[model samples]
Target: MSTEGRSAEPVSATSALESAGFVRLVARADGDGLAASGLIASALAELETPFQVTVGRTIAERSARVDPPTNEDDRTIVVGAADAAADTDDVIRLPATDRPATLEAVDLVREIGGTPDPVLALAGVVAGGSEPGAGESEWLLETAIERGLLEQRPGVAVPTSDPIDGVAHSTRLRAPWSGDLDATREALSDAVDGDSDALDADDHRAIGSLVALDAVGADEATDATAESIGRLLRPYATPDHAFATLGGFADVLEALARTEPGTGTALAMGHDVRETALEAWREHGRRAHAALSSASTGRYDGLFVVDVDDGPVETIATIVAASRSPEPVVLAIGHAEAALATREADSLGATVDGVARELAGAEPETEPAFEDGSEIGVEYDVGHRRSYLRYDPDLDNSTIIAAVREFR
Candidate 1:
């Protein structure tokens, strides 16, 4: 695997500020946060980018108060004190007086890289044909982990959760996605009813995610149905586990959405899934973007953030598609890295890029449609940071659907 670092010429703190699009300062209503905010504001002012500090109880609350940047000269940075980082989206701690947090913000957006073709690199790793250097491997692995396809163990990698065990009445451990949804659903229902309380954490997480997936994929599902499944999960799952499980289920919906047109409208699964996931995030008192940023199990390469500000939807789509879907696609929107990265599907990334181009070129549609019988057509929403696609089983979108059906 290629171990090349970003080839783009890195910019300096000054340039980063001049081009700053939005700046948000998030601090706790405490002394430390106030001090950090004062320091950060001074630092940004030196760089000619004025920063205003605000004290809030939570990042979501602060982010809600922040207006979008007015122009290219404007930017937003959230400086969370001791524990303020938990709620804020783009956050930094006061590292040292000599090395203020504001400078870190500059560095985040300044050092742009020529991210390797993540698709190709991931393909190589999956094929076992090439070994990526430490840096590349970290990116690929982290990307995969982010997608919920892999989890980091003490010294090895394992599937994030266990597979479906007994479909009906048997007792066996298998991938949850292994069999037909009917059998899997029945098995989960029985298990939960029988004695979910007796199951171990691993079993609970595995079953919970799969059950959630079944809820989303079912022909007839409602808000109540979704909530019930969530309640079943709540008794045994943490916010992170809930997030991961919903993400795993999202992968199922993404696959169905691609192969089955009109599915989005028929089940309105996209809206439901998105709402449910967001609900989970809120119930746990976590901001979706902040939670996603910290969700990485391992972080070797450091963090990167970008301001997409009025960027093309196709560009955003390319970035989202770069993430292996079916898992909840938690994009730190405007937080740019490699636009096309994956684990097993090297070509999937490239294919998504092509699909993104088609999406960008076509008239934006809120409704879904079969696009040239390939993938479903849907529009990308920047603020929502999501794309909703419909699945029409009647449509003969097999050619393109076949291309991505094997991704999982």
Candidate 2:
């Protein structure tokens, strides 16, 4: 009942060890300790012959001990896991489940065993998962050819029927392009209609991914579907979410632009969606720049001002407002606004909104609050029970805020 290194595959733990020539067990303490340990202990229990189980804490330590020539027992071949180290001629390396070492480990194992069958070794490494480190075109081709999974050509390896169909089906499933566009639009819209702020990166990406999937179907309704899908995606297109990593949505937009420029325009939400997506890519740069600029000023990096009016900001504001007393209202302001607001908030008792130019300033209950900026507001019940009056863009500012104050 050892939990260590147990493979889900039906093969007995001793069988896996015997296949690898009972070479040293190489596993990382952090990476594959549990799984590797299970397999090692299982082999020890099943084998009639005696072999010592040596645990290498680090990759360097493991590499130093795994050489067959230096080992005191010629009969004992070490089996171990390592993050990374020089490969030995006699050692068989199993990739750690988490953060496994380089793909070179596969070649290293094959090299030691004097067999070019990477599929067998990699199957043992990945267990049930797809072969590791084969996502790239070149790597996939090389591995496929080397393992006789693909027909080798001058430039690329030609996948056989199984591989070709597998790739195509997997791609479709990943993007799910066959869904009904109109139905998808309504369902997604309803999901977010209640609270766009509730939508996170994954949600937005799902919307983009739906659009991609719809476009792939290329049905008679595709022209209309493209436009409707774009409209649905409009609100979520911010500098965040990275605009869908694989760019299937962007490709869909480009294809739509050729067929229906109007839909493409709407997809852009009246602005260039590609340009905005590119800017989203630049967000990391902006954050890095902000981090570097603020680093020298002895400023705390943890504090960021989210524009309380922003869709995501509104979700937090709702949570804070509903939260128990002394819970600080969250503001979603821009980096520049955060910098300036932190400076002026103490003096003015408020921060101003960049887009609305409204004051989110605080004042005594007796004093009148600033107008216009009430659209983005905060509330708290501490000390004087000051309420930063505001509106959820979905509702009327006056009506909602007034109803909220009625509770106080």
Candidate 3:
């Protein structure tokens, strides 16, 4: 096995990866994540462009079973770079509820001489990849529909939760055009601090249309459903962060289930499955909380904050933008903004004007809210900060669905 601190040329998959728009990272099965990361860092200095790697497989198989008994050997070879460093430390934390841009992973790959092709799509389906018996396609349909990134249609899901909307089709995860991780990250962050006035108008409009959908359809979904929708559009959302955002919703929903027995029954799942979802949500909460604590202690590489202001369109836009710093940015805000972020996104205008307009809805005066609540905006809404989102909204739910379908 190649020893750590030694340089090695990239593997032979370079050509194949070029076609797939992915870079291959190769790590020794015995390496630790830090060591692997160190080596990849060196390799990145020698590559053409940035890249991301998959560490070759899910986390479970990487740390154990790959040693002698598994026949693969115990090297911590991250499949990211053909020959970069890898180990337990570089884990893509169990994502809260959304998919990652593959930028960070790709950066590691590129560091090890792999090309970085940012993956596009929300990651709910891929997150399930690690779970046995999890249906990737289902997550794709469910989360995407929930987010309004995909329109509920015939094959995709129960249209409108009414079963009568007939057909469903979602926006594909892969953008018709290439999506840049940096650009996406920037836009997402911008949304966090956005003044609402400056947001690409499309973003605002898109958001507006979505919340309007929820308000319009609020009568259709059970109270739980409407609340569920409200829980998602947090002021601090990015595509990948939805995972954490959902955890809170899941928690509230769970509490709701305990209070309303019929709600859980309505899902029509076995007890074991319910247990599993709960188990996952618990883990999600724990992980997010842990991340938050780390950020609080200044122990991480990103900016993590729970205080986000919602007001003058410009103020909100500014806050969202600031949250996108590469440093981890954890945010907290209201369900109004959260739901608005994920719901009816497709129906909202996909232009700058549309996006900016949506920010206006956060105004207490403009939309529905509890009494005594600020009508135009909520200052430092804690509900928006989620350890998982860190304000990077580039996830394409459709892309996640596509990958899940491919894997399935």
Return the TM-score for each candidate structure. 0.27, 0.22, 0.22
lDDT of 3 at 355: 26
Report the lDDT tens digits of candidate 2 across residue range 1-408.
011232212133223445442344433321122223333433343443344445443233445565554443322232333323344433444433332222333333233332223322222222211223334224633664464443311110001111111112111111122222334335346323445435555654554454445443433232333432332232212122222211223232223322333333333222345544332323322332233222222112322222322221222222222221122223333211221111111211222122112222222234333343432332211101111223223333333323322321
The clash numbers for all candidates, in the given order, read 32, 26, 118
Q: What are the Cα lDDT values of the candidates?
A: 0.32, 0.29, 0.25
Stretches off by above 4 angstroms in model 1 are: 1-72, 75-185, 195-198, 201-344, 348-408
Better of 1 and 3 by lDDT: 1
Report how far residue 329 has shifted in candidate 3, in Å.
6.7
RMSD of 3: 21.5
Candidate 1, residues 314-343: lDDT per residue as tens digits? 222322222213232212222211122222
- Model 3 CA deviation exceeding 4 Å by range: 1-72, 77-275, 278-408
Cα RMSD of all models vs. native, in order, equals 17.8, 23.2, 21.5
Q: For residues 251-272, could you state the per-residue lDDT of candidate 3 as single tens digits?
A: 3232222222233222211122
Ten-residue segment with the worst summed lDDT in candidate 2? 152-161
Q: What local lDDT does model 2 show for residue 39?
A: 37
